[model samples]
Target: MIDINFGSLFTVELLHSYYKDQLCPDFNILPSNQTVKTLGGHQIIARQYSNQLITGVNCNGKINPPKPFTAIETGAQFTFFMQLNNPLFFNYTNLSSATPGKIYYFTNRNNNVSNGKTFLSSKIAVYNAANTYAPGDLVSNGTGITYRAIGSSKPGNTFNLTNANHWMVVDKNQYLTEADALKWMPSISAYQFASPQASVNISVLGYDNIATTYTQSVFSKTIAFANPASSFPLDLSFLQSGKYSLTVNGIQQWIYINDELSDSKTFAVIDIFNDASPVSCNLIDGSGALINPAPHYSIYFLNRATIWKYILASKQSGNINDTANLYHFANPASVITSLTPIPLSNKALNLKLTLNNHDYSPIACADPQRLVTITKGTDTYPCSEIFLNF
Candidate 1:
């Protein structure tokens, strides 16, 4: 599907109730090929497709954890949960239009002879033998009739369809719908889309840079494409681009690194920036500050990190210990050309630099704002623009 990429401004404009503009899920546009070309403009990148996975017993019939038969259509950018074995015999509740006793062939969204060939190659394990299936959705040797992903004609999972030993096609994201996609996994990130509903074919290079100190960008959580350090979460929602604050009581205390709430990563743990009792300490900047906690920034009792991310917003009173440690990011733009004398605390952290057009502006130090960018080797990294107070 083609989409317009006016700016984050447009995405913001959409926050209001009702469909002010069409970014994704604007189904009215799916009329024909010409309609696809018209709305699926340059800005509308990627398609959201359904990638299915299964969770049955890994053995001949037992189901397992983390699931099996899991596949990700990187083009759609999500995983699927297709329990590839026979349907389970639900007493009553677990039946649907697409369920047992009803073996139906979902004709290709883009039906064609080649599409026919792809389905033939695909295979689905039927768990519930009691259910009535299609007259001939399956085909097996003399052992028994098995439900085939296809019927007749050119057989096999098409193109890269089902043709695989363990079907997980790398980092593929199908540009599809959220209801279908996020079932792939939430915080995995999902979006509605306009469509040819086909895979997006572009030479995408996902990379990132780690600056000792980073200058801020305007995006509440900027669309930082590069990868980050091992400690940060891969589902970089909080770090993306958005606005959120840390408050104690009602006053503001600190800011987070990115926009959106941070989700749990495999190795992620939240370290407290402030507390009442001082652990071994390192004083930073002019002040070894441990100020009061604003309502928004209070952590009653630091909780252990697991799959869930919970900010310590003080709900009860017992967990109050108002000692905090402060850390400042090194201002990046203030280039110290050749300071024989290091500008210490006597001088505020400041830097002077010449300005030209939009290149040399001070970074907007705001929370959830973007802080990084990725450039190819030939392209210059953007640290030189930071002008700080000396």
Candidate 2:
């Protein structure tokens, strides 16, 4: 019997061997970096413009400092879940008790830099301290010392000076200084941090353009896309000229394909396979334009143990006018849910139910106690409401 010791193996492999075939991504050909403003890490990261709590996203833990087995550089361009509970940046921030959309302003006190901060009209969207704001009117808060928005054209955006509850007032200690300010912006804001996952000088892929080969880690899975590519719909034969490659970020069974031709044609997702659960899709076009697919499909299992399926025969194209990040893609594959036909109850009630949007519905049974009224455009129909307990 031969005994093999694993401990001696580490002594065998040299440091250079670990990075032998390792390739530092081509910074040039890759897509644009996802420029963003990083807030706090491993610590409570927040911001204030004219003295209010605009947004204070917390860092993993001891953010400003490094910990054991945790590299400070890991928090460099990205935040780590090990330090912060999220470990992932898919954070959903909404208006809550302590948080609300607040105005963030950046003014050149000295006006030294040629291209000083440019002020963008504030909206309901999130704002970091990196933005430019013109103080509106200086009004007194209930505390008597009031803060104001910079622009006079609009009503003065004021904050409570007494309490730090406002979105623009973080404790002097928690606020980010100018040195670490850019991290609080959006990732796509620059070209450095996000360079690794890009293919060419493009940040987001154009229709039919091949995306840079990259890997993304989400939750507990690492998804790799083959030289990420894009597709646009044309005559079906034209699209067939490209080769199809696939990489999956979900379970190994789930798949997404990258079909790219040598020339710059539009890229289209060939298929999404092995998705047995409820899901949604975003249908958009090149230049991040949202294209409404006339025919759309959906399938989902409600939280109450019921399955549903829908097929949209047509859509109102106007709905796709939102921005790139806000665009939605539609389902290309047939939605397969566990929606079995069940017999409707025979019971009849005074207040009958009326359902609409029958265009996306398939032939299925309905609850006898309720009435169904489906409408696709001007056409309308009332399904036979027969009641039989059996």
Candidate 3:
């Protein structure tokens, strides 16, 4: 019989919330070193380098701690609870049908403040003899005209086209009935009519590297408003990694799905000016030609340390009066100084330049190292060997 001893065995207890936006109120207090007994009654010391506590059980009793257990792991082995804070109401003000003078009218008579913009009350109802009307109330006269009430009217007073003191014609388009307007109103707010029954169509199309040729229709979803508002998930897990365009109603935006297989290299020329100069440096490409039109690339300074490749500074192309192909860094040192967790002192760094298309697809350079090593004391450097002074 072979007796293999694996040292002491123990369990670690952790109390934490697995919420996505949960914040740590205070630092956790944990034992830096703990003594435990093995199955054979041999004593062993368990230790933790970090004072912070994480969610995991150290069953192997290894000196190095285990990583934090995730919700996916718990869902597979044990019963897990998930709470979704979904949106239950959609504001009718955001609907394309609610443009000014269309389904509703806005007047400065009763102006209010909302989200730093002038808020005008919407008149979205037809003239009703039984309904009491207030100032700035908009109502349709059942024909092809819309009127705004300048003065309060009692419940029994019917709207008259000749009543200039109480009513003013604002729009002559086809009047929208109260029932039509209620279809787009919010379901939970103070101005809610009934559960909004409006629906919207969303379409997604996949594309190739250039985005000029369409690949295929990726997804099409129709969201029907059953209760003022509802939330639905867009499951694109089945899509192959590539560029895609999403269209909601008529508005479209580009999106990229990265499978971690895309190359991130590009060719760039670096020029470092003298200290205390107005502009610290400029970055261009080979052939001494600027990238042109601006903001098509991003530059980053990364420390060359083995353990931690800390980002010393990062800047995007484009500056006022800088329209050429070259990206000018006005003050490179100020960029490093403004970092949240500043970089370490006296560490040698390298510059990484990445170029992208207008749609943000990586434009890989044919020769990655065409820009050679840039040594110190030289007037200009390539993309390597940079040391910044504090």
* Tens digits of lDDT, candidate 3, 17-109: 111222212122222111111211222233322321122222222222322111112101110111112121011111122222112211122
The candidate with the higher TM-score, 2 or 3, is 3
Question: What's the distance in Å from true for residue 37, model 1?
Answer: 8.0
**C-alpha lDDT of all candidate models, in order:** 0.19, 0.20, 0.29
lDDT, candidate 3, equals 0.29
> What tens-digit string does per-residue lDDT give for candidate 1 at 105-139?
11111111121121211123322334333211222
Instruction: Return the clash pairs for model 3, or none.
Output: 290-325, 291-325, 292-325
Name the best candidate (by lDDT).
Answer: 3
- Candidate 2 global TM-score: 0.14
lDDT score at residue 380, model 2, on the 0-100 scale: 33
lDDT score of residue 46 within candidate 2: 25
**Descending-TM-score candidate ranking:** 3, 1, 2
- Tell me how far the alpha carbon of residue 362 in candidate 3 is from the true structure, in angstroms, after superposition: 39
Could you tell me which 10 consecutive residues in candidate 3 have the lowest summed lDDT?
A: 74-83
Provide TM-scores for the models. Answer: 0.14, 0.14, 0.19
